[model samples]
Target: MKRWIPWLAAAAVVVLVGGGAWRAMAARQQQQKALAQAASQRAEAPMQLAASELVGVVRRSLVLGVPVSGSLRATESAMVKARVAGELQGLTVREGDSVRAGQVLARIDATESQARLRQAQQQADAARAQVDINQRTVTNNQALVNQGFISATALVTSQASLESAQSTYRAALAAADVAKKSLEDTVLRSPITGQVSQRLAQPGERMPIDGRVLEVVDLSRLELEALLSPADSLAVRVGQRAQLQIEGSAEPVVATVARINPSAQAGSRTVPVYLAIAQNRGAPALRQGLFVQGLLDTGRADVLTVPLDAVRTDKPAPYIQAVRDGKVAYLPVKTGARAVVDGQTLVAVEGAPEGTVVVSGRMGQLREGTAVTTAATPSAPVAAASAPATRPAP
Candidate 1:
């Protein structure tokens, strides 16, 4: 009975081991089948992209421009100052008043000048009377000498006295002329035709020689002083045209390059280029000291271009995500001048063809060689049983 019990136990252990091995084999087969299924599904699935996420490359005629910023200034401006010193009697012109050349802008006290002129005139008259008396005396002496009533030496003395009197009269006349000029200077006049920008003196205020009285600026002819880098300056030339975007003006003002500084500015490498604004009817009125931005047209050429936002420049070599044969491909590109067309900034590129399709935005997670579906033709939904063997035609 004991031997029979041992055999029975051995058979029971064998059966238990066989059952455990079969369970392990079944689990391994299930796992293998699941992995194979997953791989097949992934291979058959197509990456999908919406139509709104794509942009097409196109050829465009780009007018290359160099960007510059500066301020607008009057082409002709002057600081009107007091040429002669006097009490400011009245200022006829104020700031922002339009004035013509030789217009009386201010008046000074002319009482003192008038008095000096009168005194000089009186002196001149006295000198002239004295000269007349000397001439008569010389004439009488000559007659007396001719009649043998006077010596030659006496005649010479009379002639010398007459000459001295004539010299004194001439000096007095010169003084009178000076006084008259000083009186005329009492009235300050505008040297230019323009609007008055500033008023520095008031009526009844004492002014010194060359004292500032007013500032006049010709706004009709305005100019922009654009500062450019060394490289950009080399490309600029006189007579080139540009468009100026002033701070307050809604429309861009047209300008022409009038002059370029021969040398760079002191303490900096920037060069000053002056652009003269063209006055056109229906254009916004420009004022001095207004900040402005400009685009100087350097050249124009036809080139393959794409939307500015489509190109990625963060990498050492710029690149764009281009789709080819239903896959996203990373294409390296070299970019050049940029232009604004219809309010969109388009950049000139050298690599891609004109009809290439590229991912324009929202490319954070996109990878190279990623399968994709065009926004125009979306991929079919995954079937409940199995994925389609072939993708649908785009």
Candidate 2:
């Protein structure tokens, strides 16, 4: 009887253990099934968004510009030099002084020139007196020949003397004219209207003919000397517009293609392109030899564009999050020119079609084919209480 009681006890313990294990397994299976059902319901649910969050893509003309860098220079520039040699006696203009065409800028010491002119004038006068005396002598000789008081040979000699005196008088007159011209050249005048950029000679300094006095440049007629490759030069044409950004200048100066050098630079394949600055009201002051950067507008085309922020750049290829049929759709796009339109920075895109609605601002996490709802239109406001209300339906 005792042995039978021990076996029964063992069987009861085994049954209790097996029952506990089965219950644990059942609980785990039910928990996993519940989790799977919850996930499926969430996936079927739609995503909702406000209408104001979406921005429509637009089509507009985008101007494309080719970037170039070079230096700024005056289109018309001259180095003021002395035409005659003398001591620079007076200089009325200095560096940075504005001058007009034909304005006298400096004076050379003309004391010696003046004295030489006067001396030549005196010689001319003496020669003229000699000519007068010779003329009277020739007239006397001719009368003597008519009266037969003197031989014909002697009268001919007197005529030859008069001719000699006339030649001397002409020579003296030419010398006087030369001296007058030299004296007039002692004053240096500006040949063009411009500002003095350099003062090469000081007052009271002696200078020779063609000696540099100052450098004058026409500031209003400035140009940018841009170097372009052979390929780029072909695209640039005369009359094309460009924007120049000079070093140290806050605003860009507008310019146009003035001329293109037919030949390439020596030893280099680059061509020299000259851009003429356009005249503008209140244009910023520009100087010669200023380093500059330029953007030449080559062509323009109509393209689809969206706000810069709407394009996502982190992925392997640039794409935009577009909302189509109330579902999220990712679109891969190729970007082109970037420009500002209506006070917003917009990027030109190629793949996206016009009028495609894109998610402009950062909304919560969005997935492919995720459902969305735009904000509903607002209902009309109710009439004021003071106003007569419509009667209840009969």
Q: Per-residue lDDT tens digits of candidate 2, residues 45-107?
A: 877666556776777766656666777788889988887898997787887899999999988
Q: Quick one: best TM-score, which candidate? A: 1
Question: What would the per-residue lDDT of candidate 1 be over residues 140-211, giving only the tens digit for each residue?
Answer: 999999999989999999999999999999999999999999999898888889999999988889999899
Residue 350 in candidate 1, Cα distance off native in Å: 3.1
Whose lDDT is greatest here? 1
Q: Which stretches of candidate 2 lie over 4 Å from their true place?
A: 1-64, 151-156, 301-394
Ten contiguous residues with the weakest lDDT in model 2: 384-393
Cα lDDT of candidate 1 equals 0.82
Distance from true location, Cα of 199 in model 2, Å:
1.0
How far out, in Å, is residue 140 in model 2?
Answer: 2.5
TM-score of each: 0.76, 0.60
lDDT of each: 0.82, 0.79
Error of 1 at 226 (Å): 2.0
